[model samples]
Target: MSNPPELPEFPSPFNFINNVPITLVELRMRNFSGQIREKPRWWEKVHDADIVAKWRSEIIEQDEKVVEQFWGGEKRFDDGNGEKKWPREKITGAQLDYIFDELKDLAQAIDHETGIQRTAIDKVYQSKTLIPADLKTVFLSGVSILESVPPEEQDWHPGANDQVLDLVHPSLHCFRIGRSPVLIPERTSGCPDPLFVLTEEQYLEMREDAEGAIVSQFISTNYQWLPTDFEVSQPGRRLYSNITSILQRFLPLFERVLSDSSDPPPPLAVAANPGGWYEDEESESDLSDDEMDARWRKFHWPVIHDPAPFSPPTQEGRTPLSLNGRKLQVIIKLANIVLTPERPKYPGGSWHVEGMVNEEIVATGIYYYASDNISESKLAFRAAVGDGTDEAGVSWNYEQSDDRGWTVAFGLRQWRSMNQELGSIMATEDKSSLGRGRYSAFSLSTRRGPSSRRATFPAATIVVPRRAGKVPALRALPQEIWDMIMQYALAGTVSLEEAKQDRLALMEERSHFVIEHNREIFEVEFNMCEH
Candidate 1:
């Protein structure tokens, strides 16, 4: 046949073949181009076939030489004798190259699901008649090399080539690619060791997540041991502020989480948690117990002391906001008066406030519904006035806990001064003087309200001392002398010159009368002449 003339150019390369118009055979060839004409692509061996086998073998041979060099031409076989041992040394660039170069040894079959032998892979790649396949492989050989090298043997000093690190990083497989899990390297190098295997972004992200978790843990459990502003570093400052901001933002959710009484909490759509810079050493470490305790008291006490922004408790019809300020003030004043006989030092009472406001004691009583003996409205408080009793052996009216019952009592002798009301208040076995007298010493008998076993203060009832039937002998003093005595008692002052010249001064100087409240009255007669 005569030589066929050239066909007209078509839009695509497969539009025509052998000087003929487009056909099925040409289309088939176009669809599977490289299968019929196999070309060995060594560059793509890692993802295709074992063309890089030679490269892998060479790198392994080089690694052996590098190992020899590391030992200074002397090898130790660990002969189980104490006589000879190899000294620890840093790795070299040549060793790093050999370690990373072994990545080429891995080969996958045409299906890319299982491993294939290097010999079979080589045949698949070089065979001219063999069909092309996506014979991808996972490069575990380099990972094996890295895993074999101990961390101590790695050169961890700075000043390594960035390109070399970049080349070695992909083989370490620190993270995942799609559904496949990556294999992290056992050995690392460079200052900030992760730099040898992780990108800066990845490293930063990991650190940030870790710091946030630490912050969360501290907020949940170690709030008492937080560091103070003076003791905190710059990063710690950021951590504190960040945590505070996060708390403020999600305070309601946290309150709900905390208040949930059920076994399994209801599902909540949590907000994006903010990150912080709380130092792991300061918050997470167990070292320096005393120092941590001090810091916790210094830094976190204020939060515990105030805590107004958080959820305020509620009583009958009152809220914590209404009760905390003026109400607390009134309670504190009365507590001071009722608790002072035995409590020489005043650090303020442990007044737990629930709710507030109104005119009379009856209408304004903080109602507490006791679910059970142990379960009462959160609006209750327990206070301690004195260590024990006054000289007269009468216990100062205050809260006391025992195995059987917990006596929670409070009274204000001068209720008018506090601008507080009184009403149907409960009494305990110990007997409180909180009676329904407008201005009289209001005392409530202990056994009047609830059983001593449960010791539940009645709802809508206040605890006050009942009025004493007899006036304490200290009140029997003449008003003038009593006023002088009170002034002297308050001032804790005495002078001889003033005593001889003035009646008030004489009373103050001649006698040291200790007016004991909440107990029997007694007077101490003093003779200045004796002194």
Candidate 2:
């Protein structure tokens, strides 16, 4: 084989892996520049035996406190003001808030591996034009606060019921619920902020009650801390206004970081996946060709035997194992493929494929292969697909959408259960095309069959008739259709030969541009790998 290309030289001993900074803006690549090491605590040391004895004593004390405050505390208090009347110094709301603040600070410092200063994660996802509206409508649904009253606990806060937890998810930002009504005497330190989001619909359904219940229970009872307002200016008097900003966080990623108690990950080493082991395993499990053919025939019938008067295209194609290299099937999904009558109609003739299902129009999204030019050893794409009524109701599977339904291709190295796949560019060319001012254009799979390098209509999408207004047909390749198909070299779509010509032209233009500004064109990077 050939040598693996070396990573482009970057900076010194503080290299990318364990050192380079990354942020939302520079999410161009996933490879990191650092090591994941266990942080050791120093300076405060004790002998092993002494440490064990101290831990045992602490456990015993905690258990005794639990029992004294919860099980029998009720028998002691007459008016629910907790058992022992501990002073403010013993335990105050201020103390616990400080602990959370410290933890947040420590977490930030620990995760300070930095990158570029691009837009925040939440901002990119919030664009309506970037994501489909239906897909964006995600949030929390319902919330109810439970209060626990361990009578003999501290009067300042008393029982565990006083500890209020606000669980905010997508649709619903804050569901500040007290899990168990029974409260502990002193303040509970870990009132889980495992914020689970609510869907827009569920939030609308239960928002009013959940909000009221949380507010009444927290301020009216225990210590209020978890930033009731964006900034905790007057924590004692802040209301639900702060919920919006605090809720604005990228809840999913934060939740993963904070609450995930995942098992210890398996070590990453070459010995774990030796090549011979996989080969032998596959050899042992080989299936007979005859059996494979029999199974194949089972799926060979025309998807649509007696097609509907206005039939849709067949989207039930499998990854013809005959054509399998890498499971990656990247199709530039456009919005116009949406053919459900509830929303829009197809461009021309009804759906017809090598096989068709007896439906009005081929339901919608069709999956297929890339062009020969895309045969470059490695290439990635930016993609978008329609999430409409066709994908809803019943014809397709259950769908999840955000507030604004525009979709974007994030990484090519993902197994998307949706349209389009993405990755990095290995090598490529480009080209451009022009609309004949009139004839309708349709996109179809142009992958080569096994027989020859010759291409065939392996698949086709049912085009919904688009009324391209004054948006010059050539320029308006319909955001969905022309977005990815544009030949990179030409700045738009073009024939193979034309794309090659464009590549040459771009190289020449770049050469001139660089001569005009040579210093910056070729960056001189320094490295300390060996030096």
Candidate 3:
């Protein structure tokens, strides 16, 4: 994994497994080889069955322990005064992808499906294909994927020496996510039925996996909160670019950075997110009621002073790309990614991005969509002039319930309005939930036609860190601004000048979270990841 870790979502503790660290990847590649079945009395002559069997179970246990180490949270146990606790995490997308890639190779080399399974975990985690039992045994015995490894690699192959005795199980029981081709870990880690225990040597492998998981978890937990070490690349720079392709379509409403004035407006202010620096510092928090009201005003509409020295948002041909030839620093706190399936009949969709700064809705925006057949773009976006509610006040939004058990504000009314709009688009709604759809949003497809301006749309389809739906790949702003804000947040001190930095850091971390882990609720694997 050459990835320089970016900021993470849910703070440092929750993150993606970028890549198996280079050293470990190479080492494990050697120690985990299975025996070929063609040899006579292969179980006895080629390998020790008893030793293999013992190792097999140990491998599974070790894998589970790794999950526990990084993510386990306390389940309340009865204490005289109150419930006591532990910690937890789930499996991430990167881990799942790694497994899938490895399995693909094993499947090709083995004769029987079970053969591939055995070779993959050889005293590692046990994985059986969901095929029939009678077929399973034959597959296990005949499947020899030794050929799958090139000859040079064969001698170099490593088997989990500690779990060297755990033999491969015959039964397969893997699960898939909907129509997605990827297979995930089974929810239950119950001892594999017909599971054989491990020999002493075989038990060593689990310890290794546990150690690896722990290291990975530690890196994941720390990197997220710590500053990133990334050198700005094309993708990073684009986030700060003046190109506004989608914003331009909405034609000049984007009030980009201001030129001429060296001073940033007072509107810019930074505030620490609760549980950000150190999980809730006090049992009671410190937000004033007036502060909450001010935030409401900002989310509803942009606030400009009566004297208005700085020009307010005006529909000019896309606000100038550069404010004094520089990009403004800001973080887009990406709260959620909703795959909304809206009015199926109309060539339209929208995304409601919401976040608070200084007790104000500094990052509220709706990305609107329409068929840009003339432009040849299927998904162009229309952004509001400011991070506020529409002129009509038709939509409002809020946060869903979370594990912390803390009280938070929600925009159920806004969600209901959004639900109606989407229902009208798709012509479908849960009979029980009525106009309010059963879920927040659903997936949608964008079709581009020849000669059309690549059907552009604002990020209305789902909630993401930045609005990639309408904008091009995000351009990275100068690293100076990002680091400054991150530092301020950690220090538990925020200033107006550091406003943009705060917003940007928050978003950067959120995106990192999404990329590293599955964003969907159903996709998270708590037992396999760090919570």
Candidate 4:
């Protein structure tokens, strides 16, 4: 008897196999590879002579106004004489040309289709006037929820050193899928299907009921109330309808980013050179250190050369990118930073993503609704491209001598983890000036799956710790005795030992779940050669 020969595996373009879906991380990687050599949509527009000329003319025409608007007033230049004059009145022709050139470059970098500002492609979107003017009153009314909380009862974000106030944070009471017991009965074969969730009418009705319950509690507690208390006259609903309305307004922008990430277009066969890079060494001898360093960036910057057209694999029954009939889990977060003479500067935030692997968060939208007397802040973005292992045989086949050419063309460094640096969005007073307090709303969109269920927190379980104070009795006890006392205090039950054991088991289960989920999505090796 002869054994059958092993068949060679063929690569499939589809994002699924046997009805099972691929991870979002893998899809992002695929999209990245697919567009490796493709030029950005703005490449041609930025290079067109007529377009560049038009942009230059426009900048020159609006130079004075632009200067005033940016500088927050007319900026006067100090001439050698005693007189201080406007920049246009005192500056040379070269200074004006330089300003115009910079503005032109900025205008060229923006892409209308993606609504992406600067040179970061389609990753970030910003709008100054997305929320309607009428919604301002409603938003302020919702903000009263935070203002109502007493200073002593305010919930500062964990580990934020009393700087960040969390009015409504999902991390405190989030929907825990699969861990909690299911309340809703499972659908049977003959049972009618449930109506769609998050519809405008249904949402408003739910909000009204929830708001009433919350306001009822506030009134019962005699909290500092305001005329805007009517806005949040419900329980369960943390944010008023104002937040919902704002999210609805930005839905289009969210959709655009999601579409680009999930189902990107095939790469186009076009060559785009951004220019201004020193391509030859002839001019290097006369250049200064800064000039040389600037020119050398072309070698280090990532760019794809001679990109060929790409045709993605076809999936027979693939669903198009849309939110029309899908179920979405939205986690809302509202927080504000208070800066005074004592604490004038916010040192900025660290680099991190939105949620844990188990959360299945696909997209995040942040709205800086208000700020005052603060310096400029920016929200930058970066992505984990790869661990450099994938590029060794495929994209890194150049010698040291060819480093300049390779880097200039490919825009990647060899033998290193690829952390693609995306540009930033500036958050300033002029950009987001709705109220006196510096408030921000964060909405994280997580895709709901069939096996997932929302978990609710019991009001009794939530314990807000008192302000810093020493417990003299506990401080005198040994470490082991102190730990046991804390465990008993936390359990508050006769079966304290059993509860402790159960807690350990639950912790292990959650840890395993998170690790497994992340491994499935992010731990695999991405094949860059596929594209």
The digit string of per-residue lDDT tens for model 1 on 1-531 reads: 443232221111101111111111111112122221122443245443343345445444544554354333323221112221111122233332322232233222231321111221111111111111221011122222422456554322122221011111111211211211111333212212211223334433433222432222211110010011122454345433432332232222221221221122222111111111112334748648897766643333100011112122233432111111111111100000111222212122122121111101111121111112221111111111222212111222212211011000011111111111111122221111211121112122232344222221111221111211111113344475446445534443324333223333222321221112111111111111111
Q: For candidate 4, lDDT tens digit of each residue in 1-531?
A: 543332222211111111111122222222322222122343455456675567445544555463354323322211112111122222224433433343345455444543434222333455455555567556756676665778886766555556667666544422222221111223212333211123333323432212432222211110110111122557425456666676566566555545445453333223334232224455668889998876655333323332232333355543334444333445565677755444444565544333332233345566666655454455554343332244433333344433233233333333333333333445532132110011222211222322111111000100001111110112344576446455544433324344334434444444454454333322323333422
Q: Count the backbone clashes (under 3 Å) in each candidate.
A: 26, 84, 90, 14
Give me the runs in candidate 1 sitting further than 4 Å from their true place: 1-43, 47-50, 70-72, 77-220, 223-531
> lDDT tens digits, residues 44-120, model 2?
22223464345335434543464355324432222122222211112222322332232223333322221111111
Global Cα lDDT for candidate 3:
0.24
Greater-TM-score candidate between 2 and 3 = 3
**By lDDT: ranked, best first:** 4, 3, 1, 2
Tell me the TM-score of model 4.
Answer: 0.46
Range of the 10 consecutive residues with the lowest summed lDDT in candidate 1: 402-411
**Which ranges in model 2 have alpha carbons more than 4 Å from their true place?**
1-368, 371-507, 511-522, 527-531
Q: TM-scores for all candidates? A: 0.12, 0.14, 0.17, 0.46
**How does residue 369 of candidate 3 score in lDDT?**
23
